[model samples]
Target chain A: MSSTREIDALIDMMAKLPGLGPRSARRAVLHLIRKRALLLTPLADLMQTVAVTARECLNCGNVGTSDICDICTSEKRANGELCVVEDVADLWAMERSGVFKGRYHVLGGTLSALDAIGPQELRIPRLIDRVSTENITEVILALNATIDGQTTAHYIADQLDGQVTLTSLAQGVPIGGELDYLDDGTITAAMRARKSL
Target chain B: MSSTREIDALIDMMAKLPGLGPRSARRAVLHLIRKRALLLTPLADLMQTVAVTARECLNCGNVGTSDICDICTSEKRANGELCVVEDVADLWAMERSGVFKGRYHVLGGTLSALDAIGPQELRIPRLIDRVSTENITEVILALNATIDGQTTAHYIADQLDGQVTLTSLAQGVPIGGELDYLDDGTITAAMRARKSL
Candidate 1:
């Protein structure tokens, strides 16, 4: 029996998910139907709410529902330190550890020559501005171990040399490992053992 | 520098995401702010569109934009075979392989006695009804290899014992390995080598 167009549309959208495809999308849609009240309804409601309210923080380049993010506004997080990361996923990883007490600066992406991405494409300039304005004394580069990540780190360091203490997460993260893959404990250890760049 | 209530509320919701926490949620919100036009605007628009249009297929339980799913409505897919799976993720995995020509049936979940989930909790009864009414000649179970998955499969088998040709994906899927984790080639091989139940 052929599925309806609406179901196909949902499957098509689900197939676009990071790890799902058409078949899995179909199954997921089905599961949601079977558990309409318990799972599907809630999921749909949350998705709708997020769709309307979700926005990016203007100051920190984070995804939220307002102009400024919570971290950027929290006085308790202004401990003279700032953590820098290539992606929001990295920032999330650090937060999951519940160790760091400082603010954050999301660079959006790394500098990749092949992809024609440079400092102008990332939020490097904005990061520099945050250091002085936020009274940050130390900046932690919690980037991935990929070549582009290191390149971005060095570039940022050059821009902020002699201005603030620049450091990076120490050895613990495997080579080429993305911060999103590392467990919370490993991220914490790396953050604690960070070395000056 | 406390964030506005709106920003805080957004962060709180983001924190509930599968892999995010309060800190990361805050950072993500900030990043979206910096790239409002390029990333945030488009993302927000897509989220809103999906929220308004997304629904489930009335016949096959697939998520979509209308009452019936595309696959269920497509005349070309009216093959006599129906492949049953445990989740939407599983169905998408199968579709990604581009092998199976028949349609699908999403069971939503397994028959778990511990969780007090029974056949009624799933779409088993609807599946049986569809089999006879849709002129289905074969039913292929492509559930995971977990204990609960097997139990669910057995129950389904008993439900349609002599009504149609009952079969299952071959024993190629690793133990406890979800179909979503398997590659397209593996899914295709398993489907091609399905065995009689």
Candidate 2:
């Protein structure tokens, strides 16, 4: 709706965000303009700063301001148990829960045969290198339950077999998940993985 | 999940946007960082430019990069008709349809007795000034179909009664709107304002 090119460009770029569309982008831009000093300027400055400093960690593939992410650099995070995730968002999810104490390795993507993606394309070689060099005692595959995720996990498990303790996240019902709403595969997985009381 | 304060602050600010939550903000920031050269830099630059240039038009409430918006300044648009809207967003919506060739006067908000919003609080005084001074022959009250919107329309109509041709948007079923899904008020309005075949 904006006649100005700069405003239109801003809206276009905002529409490219993961959740926002063109309508929402227009609303967001107008809101930012109304609160320019409070929101627009600060957001622009922050984006500029992030653009200048943000980089992928060479060791762990996690994103941070430095070359090596804090998780890879921190001594306390090296708890001998490494968690391998398919994406940076998944790594962030794991961190938000405060469940994992070990370092993380972000694969960036899964091993997809259809897409011609191999282990080398998704930081699997780096994961193997970390396992051997970082004194990691165990490796947890925290990949999603999708077909590609499971395939990548299996490949990683096979590659690191007998080298370290290899494990995959237990498949089961999600928190607050209803059996009536769950798919057959999830129900079956939850049944097979039933633990002893 | 970012260890650096800069990235975390960026995520926080992004979360403050209208449609984004913390998770979405993190995802958007990550996406921006991943596509820094293509999207992030341009968005930041555009936002900065908009922040410096964008302002409310002095003649109308529409947002533009100049003192007077393009519609308000265009001689072709000054066809003795003024479309009044409750917000700049509504003005932009009307402009997108390309139906109304006349200029707009954004009220910024509607008359709200519950919120103690009076004529002076909104752009009602400015609308009154424009109607008398700008040789406007017809004024369209294109307010929303809400109680406040109708109330504001009545107040403006009362103020400009007998001064010029006053009209409001026709109430009826929207384009491709199904009767089964239509609300009672909408059906009533459509029935009362039915057009003869």
Candidate 3:
């Protein structure tokens, strides 16, 4: 607030971002000012470009620069398997791991009765269409382990019960996770799904 | 990384911001993309404007759009007391509190022996020049409570020993601070400066 209206406005907007608060926004604005040429200008330009170009892929609901995302168009990724995620962020996390070569279907969100979000609200119809039209053999539910996520997964599984091979992400102890730090549910799940090691 | 190059680049830049990490950056970028018209476009435009117009005040070193900041040029703020701070952010912080009515001098940094920074490295010389020129009655040292900050304060105090009335901020337990949670040094300082209420 000590700075000009523009600077104050910038700080206010920056503070609205996911991880930034008032203090951090002030620091970021100061940093951007100090590194104007090296960071601020380029960041502005890129944000403008993204503002104009970024869009959701019509085919899979994933965000991209085109009507259909790169994953949908890439021939290598069309391997008769589809990974269903609740949000684009989850899809990006999967991509970062580079473990899945199959295409993705962003559900947008889970079915929530409290919010009145049903299967029709998300990309469920599009996913069902893609499964038959795209020759998908396996449908991997990569949704979160939350209650809503589980309910949504169950709904999707029931929809494609006999149509294709359906699976969900294994619920067990995470890699590099300590047993003592895990919650009771996670410990019980890990114990129930014990490996032959 | 599943997003376009432009999107990826934006996430990377956003991650470098003070409070945001990779996950939060991705979420911010996604949010920006979704609210392009309402938030992203305007934020980008404002950033560009700030990048072009923002500058440090010639006299007080506060960041503003003019040679001298609004605080420095305001006729109402010509109160003879000058507050000295380690950075522009500190000046902003003071302004946000709306407590001080006088002007400010940003030191840019503290005098550090390890960093080879001295009085000349900061705006100490300029501050000394401004004291007589501006007819300053009092100089308040509003630096941090770090070792380097105290060292810098002592250095400044010695430099302007007899020229003007010099004072530093009082050290004590903060308002609503829990005694049990407070460190020994703070408790001791609070005891020494105990007020009769």
How accurate locally, in lDDT, is each candidate?
0.74, 0.91, 0.92
Worst lDDT run of 10 residues, candidate 2 chain A, spans A1-10
Q: What is the lDDT of candidate 3?
A: 0.92
TM-score list, all predictions: 0.58, 0.97, 0.98
Positional deviation of residue B162's Cα in model 2 after best superposition, in angstroms: 1.5
Q: Report DockQ per prediction, comma-separated.
A: 0.15, 0.81, 0.84
> Model 3 chain A, poorest ten-residue lDDT window?
A1-10
RMSD of each: 8.1, 1.3, 1.0
Docking outcome class, model 3: high
Which lDDT tens digits does candidate 1 get at residues A48-141? 4554576656787766556787788889988999999987667767877788999889888999889999889989889988898989999999
Q: Interface RMSD of the predictions, in order shown?
A: 6.7, 1.0, 0.9
Model 1 vs. true fold: TM: 0.58
Task: Please state the Cα-based DockQ of model 1 relative to the true two-chain complex.
Answer: 0.15
TM-score of chain B of 1: 0.82
Candidate 3 Cα errors over 4 Å, as ranges? none
Worst 10 residues of 3 chain B by lDDT: B14-23
- Collision pairs in model 3: none
lDDT of 3 by residue, A1-197 (tens): 66789999999998888778889999999999999998899999999999999999999988999998999899999899899999999999999999999999999999999999999999999898989899999999999999999999999999999999999889998899998899999999889988996
Task: Show where candidate 1 strays beyond 4 Å.
Answer: A173-197, B1-197
TM-score of chain A of each: 0.85, 0.96, 0.97
